[model samples]
Target chain A: MNTNFTHHQSAHCENGVASNLLKFNGIDISEPMVFGIGSGLFFFYLPLLKVNQAPAISYRPMPGFIFNKAAKRLGITVKRIKFSSPEKAQIALENNLKNNIPTGLQVGVYNLTYFPDEYRFHFNAHNLVVYGKTDNTFLISDPVMENVTTLTEAELEKVRFAKGTLSPKGQMYYPTHLPSEINWESAIKKGIKNTCSDMLAPVPIVGVAAMRYLAKSIRKWPKSKGVKVANHYLAQMIRMQEEIGTGGGGFRFIYAAFLQEAAIILKNDKLKELSFEMTQIGDLWRDFALNASRVCKNRSNVEDVYNTLADQLLHLANLEEKFFKELKKAI
Target chain B: MKKEEIPQDESNLSKSNVKELCYATDENGNYTTGLSTGWEAKTIALESSINTINERIEEAKENIKSGKASPIVYFMELHRMDWPTLADYVGLWQWRVKRHVKPSVFKKLNNKILQKYADAFQISVDELINYKGA
Candidate 1:
């Protein structure tokens, strides 16, 4: 029942799934390209929502947004389904495999046995593709993995219906139609514009402002919550910035790659320069993560470590603000 | 990051033989894909969180043994779930879920409710009721 699907490793899940699925449908698009057109780069700080006992921080949009937006921009038709019953979900997946369709699924990472134990958590927005089934096992093409893997039917079912935040509930999607011609230049411009607006949004909990708000919170955490609780929150923030999926640094690098690609397609030299600037910003994010981890581990003797970290974040917000503004003008 | 500068620090990911894909710059400053074994900062963050979870799991076991908490509390900690999250999974009210953390309430729970908790934890009812330790 194999669809002859080729597994391609990606830094991020949704972009990887989208790219791989598109390639299987004969589009031959790259992962960065898909991410760029999808306007995948984003930032949000949700003080009201708590995940793992810490405030929710997201470097990308909600699950399915990337692929859906990319598909729409590329004029590709996609079908997405969610089933309440696990039996019905299994039937639908099997039918897709029988027809040689590699279906994308949203599942929980916690129950995915193939993932390393250290990476498993209650987050339930992980994406993978099921290309075939043999006996009771399904062939999996998880974009974050280096090679193809297999999951027993029961194991797949558990992950598909894993409880907690953003439960998958046996959701699956795949592209059904691809346009013969794609207006690459226009799509790239639209993608860049959308990203610019999102990042430069005026809202406090969103975009660059969110980064600033998070910085202010970081400075207050240690003084208000005590050292131990503050350290725990800092650790959680660093995990969201560095450990989850591709994290903040990895995503910026991907976006930089997208800008570089778009530069050639749009014949814009400014985008080429902006790509390098984005990479530098990505490096700064990595530096921030490194320093924040040091503070968390108590390896830093600096008395104002929290304040230092806050300053670093503020710098990032300023740089991103300027970068997105320039990107808007360039596009 | 430059391709040559991509971190290959030893961490849980590297120890498990899992390499992360990253975008880096080549000699010409052109974007390219590279594989990072791990990074020290991320390793520290991950290890700390895991350690915290392990500590909570240990505390839950002690609480169960001392009759201060129910077997459900132990299972909940093992599954990395909090009261509200467990309630969401089992489709129960948060206060009810918290109340069920009491050993007395857990002992009096009906089979249907126990089954719901078991399903949420991905364990059989027998295992959920009789969980000793991992």
Candidate 2:
């Protein structure tokens, strides 16, 4: 059975899935709008939590947070479930398809056959849509892919239950009810306000403080850890920022897009100016990634190189701090 | 970045015939979406991590040959897993998983434990037991 779902590629997976799923329900929202309404931009540096042997760093909030937050703000009722058994999960998904509901799923990326090999790490929490099923293959609408694809039953189950950190455990979600009227102005204001607070959060490991904390750690890494280990950590940090479906510059450009769209809807000229400033900050982040990659590739033992990178990060933190303060005032 | 400035440098995505979606500014300074083949900075970072994994795998292989580590160590590194992650996958205690990394302790493991490790690695018991680093 096919639900006649239209596929639209997006820069990030969660935003794509959220936007596509809402569109299927007749919301006609853009991916950046969904991301903005969801308050998806975030940064966290957890030194104690080890992912792939390096301190866990995330450019976005935990998976599913964006979709859930957006749904709640828009007064949409979404059904989410996690099945203990793969068989039950399959049955639930088939039921949704039979009812003409396009289902969103949280899956591990490592065993997703359609993904490019370079992108397939053990990272779980990748989101996709399963719209139809025939014979043994399920139609897949992966947001990051240029076009829709399919996955066999066995292949789907493997990734659903891919064992590791953040194992999906056969999780599936779908919007059951969308309100008749959504107050775009209020939602937009709330989203912008929350994002400003999140970025300027008081904690050291979260938001702008976390960025500065990471800068301090980067300066220490070369001296405390050897050059090889330091390089590996830098590689991990860059991978989290640039790779893994973050659009271009760690969701900065995407947020800027949201602001531009918000500026039109709210007709706030100040927002338009801040949107441009955000784009410049996104460019700065790309510059940091480029220079940091050079340090990793050169295996540079020079401590000054790391110091330069740290200064770049500190500069970014300062810019973000001022930008968020201005954003909060504009709203 | 400007729409025209989006990097299309050849990288793994280009080799795989995949283009990633990026948000860039049009000439009007408005945000627009564009497709990029890849970026060299991202490719380098990705390759560095993969290289680190491969280096660990090679070290694990050498340790297995010297009888200092078990075949499990090789497969763990091959799968890009560490002791804690593998233990989480196999539902074993951290210390037990560490014990299973020793050549002596691994050889004494029964089929039940071997089966668990095999399932975690997505390999058969026969392959897990008989793997000789080839």
Candidate 3:
């Protein structure tokens, strides 16, 4: 009769039995375990979980040639002059050029004068002007000259006639701010600030790569979804540029560090290639920045040089586009 | 059943219950319970502890089976193993991106996997040598 165990006895035993503590980890109980499963759970399991980590990158330095004297000598100027008419100014230049006396001679504003690189190429009245502060000695205010150069009225006329250039643009020389008046310190700081503004944005070069990818995908298939994807990606590219244009220098340093560290983490051939290209681009950007600082000493011209540099960077980005397409396929 | 219900005992031989109980007598001549070791309860405790360990090890082994590479290498090219030498390895890694993974964590994982295959071949060679000796 006792062989028929009552439910009441089993319930009492079950209640006395302590609950088996259940802890969940990814390991399946169905398979053969190694290193003792229960021991791992009680000891090393939690510590074995992977921790999130991102690689590090660094900021490069500005080169030495940026502050050189040759770089600082670029400037522009706008002075008031007493010419009868545009036609007269043109004739005066022609006659002076023939006689070897460039009549447009004027004294320098700050003991030294500078000329713009763009104007140096041509002898046109469009950008070139002669100034006369003293009697016979006319200061050849050829906006083209880097250092102060003078010519007599005859010399100016002879050169002008030989050059066969037309009249200057306006009637009387207006008092406009000259390019030389650009505040150098403010300009340089501003230029640096604007170029580096986009540093906070992550993997900007990769964003550029993504945009190119979307573009190619569209061309290949031309679906609405592809177009949407591309448009979304292109927006990031534009955002990257805008940030860089505003004030991203600090971010550039961070990106450099990030890339440098990433160069270590990436083990695949494709990732290795991408990271190397990225680092190389960073180096090229530094070189371009140094060249810009050297070529543009003052503020306004610095901005101009930076704009040109940005354009060159964009041209280089086109090459990245082609490379990324190959990457997408390979990946 | 009735005979089993009544505790079986032999008067001629000694029967051991094996209960170890430590008790102290107070000044009032009363026994105070101090310690008790019941064999059946102790055995249950030990068995449960061992069972918990078995469960833990099972979980760990499953995780290890499913675990990806520590650095996580996503290889699209299966022909990577076909490379003959280390000289070719650098070129193969740099072929697509024009850059090398300097630390070579990915390459290390590939080599480790390759060694496992080599072990099986080595076992075959050992067996052949033994057969010739025999």
Candidate 4:
């Protein structure tokens, strides 16, 4: 905010990007002042974004609880590591490999403590990977990320590799560039990079949940064959959700809920046909998410998802209106 | 220097003879009051400097209106002026802004600017595709 202090510089201003950290007393300072100034600027420019981009500083318990409940209802295991150092992060990757977890995991190292004066956070997913070591100093590609970037010979030499840990999980990996691979050493020196890590279930459990719910909702009205059609459509959605991950996770829930609600209201024949087509849409949503979870984390993914959902909603806008009307009449 | 507008104090600061204006001395050997340090002369110089800065700002604004000026170029031009150079002490604008505005505000502004460019691109793309059919 106060560029007047005395410097010319472009900084990575967000997502744990560290600018020059100045220390006055023995205590470390800089981040607090920067955030304060940035927040002040945000107030001045609120009209510019039209929508406010400020995120709440404190963590909300409700959303996490809701997600946890959803996960449990769908029978998927959810795990979180609040703050893992480089060494500990490496260990998590190693454990995933050793256990044959069959799930893809990528670790990101955010702010790099270069020199005390010129530290910057690098959020490039490519650079923040965990590479396996062959012997004393050889590099190997992580199995989950094998399809992505293959390490070149020169890259291996420039990036320092040290062993790191993830306590409890206790997985191991080459913690590139840290002086000591031990947890305390890595934690103290490098400073922790605030990165959010999420893991997808080995298989699409959400898909299973959707299908099970669909089957249960329709079996009551076996003579109402339209329910069967809806189940088929929902089954496809579940499959896609399982394959894709977080990208499709939100929409999968919304659509699955819509279908479940629809079965209750619609007549037998109409419900059956609606279910069949919806199941396909569900599958598509899941595929889009699973195939593109990491990719969707980018800004373009936001635009793509919004546009796709908007277009689909437009297509069904009339039908949706009719569904409401008929349900009201029946009641 | 305008014939009708010249003040009577002009003779002290801008006399016809350079000797009185540049080297006038008092009885005590200190320079006389009316020559170099007169309030009238100070006010004139301040006015002229302000006019020059205002003219420059006007030109920059025109350039920006025409879509020919870069924000960085205008910002740097504003930077070059001294505090007293402008009529209203416009350097204070930057100081006030620097003190009040937050870094996130600047970032959001930059993003909004970028989004405008993105919207412009989207419009052009739509036009291009639609026109091709015609």
Query: What TM-score do all the candidates reach, one by one?
Result: 0.96, 0.98, 0.18, 0.24
Docking class of 4: incorrect
* lDDT for residue A315 in candidate 4, whole number 0-100: 36
lDDT by residue for model 3 over A168-253, one digit each (tens)?
Answer: 23222222222434343333223223222322223432334332332343233214334323222222222222111111121222
> What digit string (tens of lDDT, one per residue) describes model 4 on residues B1-134?
11122123442223322111111123432211121212232223223333444566667656544645433223323433222221112223444334212333333444444333223222332332222111
* lDDT for each residue of candidate 1 in A111-132, tens digit (9 for 90 to 100): 8998888888888899999999
Ranking by TM-score: 2, 1, 4, 3
Best by lDDT: 2
TM-score values for chain B across all models? 0.91, 0.94, 0.26, 0.34
Report i-RMS for every model.
Answer: 1.5, 1.2, 41.9, 38.1
Show pairs that collide, candidate 2.
Answer: none
Candidate 3 Cα errors over 4 Å, as ranges: A1-84, A87-137, A141-147, A154-315, A318-331, B1-134
lDDT by residue (A1-331, candidate 4, tens digit) is: 0111111121111211111211111112232122211221110111122111111111011112322332232233445442235455545544543543211222222122221111111112212222333333323322111122333333332222211111122212221121222232222111101000000112211222222222243233223433332222222232222311111222322222233333443333443344344334434533433333222222231334433433443333233334333422332
lDDT tens digits, residue span A20-72, model 2: 99998899899989889999999999888888889888899999999898888
- Return whichever of 1 and 3 wins on TM-score: 1
Error of 4 at A156 (Å): 13
